[model samples]
Target: MREADRTTRQRLADALRAEPATPSELAAQFDLTPNAVLGHVEHISRSLDRSDERFLVAPPTCRDCGFDDFDDLLNLPSRCPGCKSEAVTEPTFTIE
Candidate 1:
């Protein structure tokens, strides 16, 4: 299908298939907010065919302390637990 005919979710899925992406990267590419990209990622994940494809998420981490153990993998954390740092890395997503 032509790019113009594809939905935002479709384009986002295509991008994921092409390579892994952070929410920020996806948001910038698609002209959407990071939160909006997360919403689309969630939708795409739910809609995937389990037999043919899988949606994978790399958990968010703390940039300062490299702490990857987050309580909620889906939600972007505001603060790091290991260190009181606000520099948390965004989770990465991909389709495989």
Candidate 2:
């Protein structure tokens, strides 16, 4: 891996270890796109899988109906199936 990429991933892992945050929040803190933050988080999750540590995810919820049965925890849902609302919350990630 490139040194800068490695450093960024390390920093991302550290930040996640410190606190749970949504992808948008992590992107803003790291000056990266949300997609980029997701990529780093995915890698971090894999790395954590090999150890005693766990990569935790708080799945997104629908603000309108409180629906949160998303099959994919990594991506944000566009709308709520329960109420068809577009106001869906983004998933939060953390390392524990």
Candidate 3:
């Protein structure tokens, strides 16, 4: 992996160690796009040693629109329909 990618993974690992953050939270914390943050997390899991054992965690996702879950104000969709709006209020964990 490149040095910058490694650094980003390290930072992500540190943040995750500190707290269980949704992808969007990490994105906001680092001023990255949500997709970018998810990409980082995915890359981190792929490149890190013991990834299967330690980095086998995924961020929460909205049941409604199948949106990647977040802790910030904006990422949360008003509602979700994939799983229905009612399910939208809840978060499902994705590990893959």
lDDT of each: 0.91, 0.90, 0.57
Question: What lDDT is obtained when candidate 3 is compared to the true structure?
Answer: 0.57
Candidate order by TM-score, highest to lowest?
A: 1, 2, 3
| TM-score, cand. 1 | 0.90
Clashing pairs in 2: none
- Candidate 2 achieves a global lDDT of 0.90
Compose the digit string of candidate 3's lDDT tens values, residues 1-64: 5646667667777777666677667777888887777667766666666465455454345654
- Whole-model lDDT, candidate 1? 0.91
* Number of the top TM-score candidate: 1
Question: Which runs of model 1 end up more than 4 angstroms from their true locations?
Answer: 49-51
Write model 2 residue lDDT over 60-93, tens digit each, in one string: 9998888999888998678888899999999999
The worst-scoring run of ten residues by lDDT in candidate 1 lies at 43-52
Q: Candidates' TM-scores?
A: 0.90, 0.89, 0.53
TM-score of 2: 0.89
lDDT of 1 by residue, 1-96 (tens): 899999999999999999999999999999999999988888898899555899989999888889999987767788998997999988999999
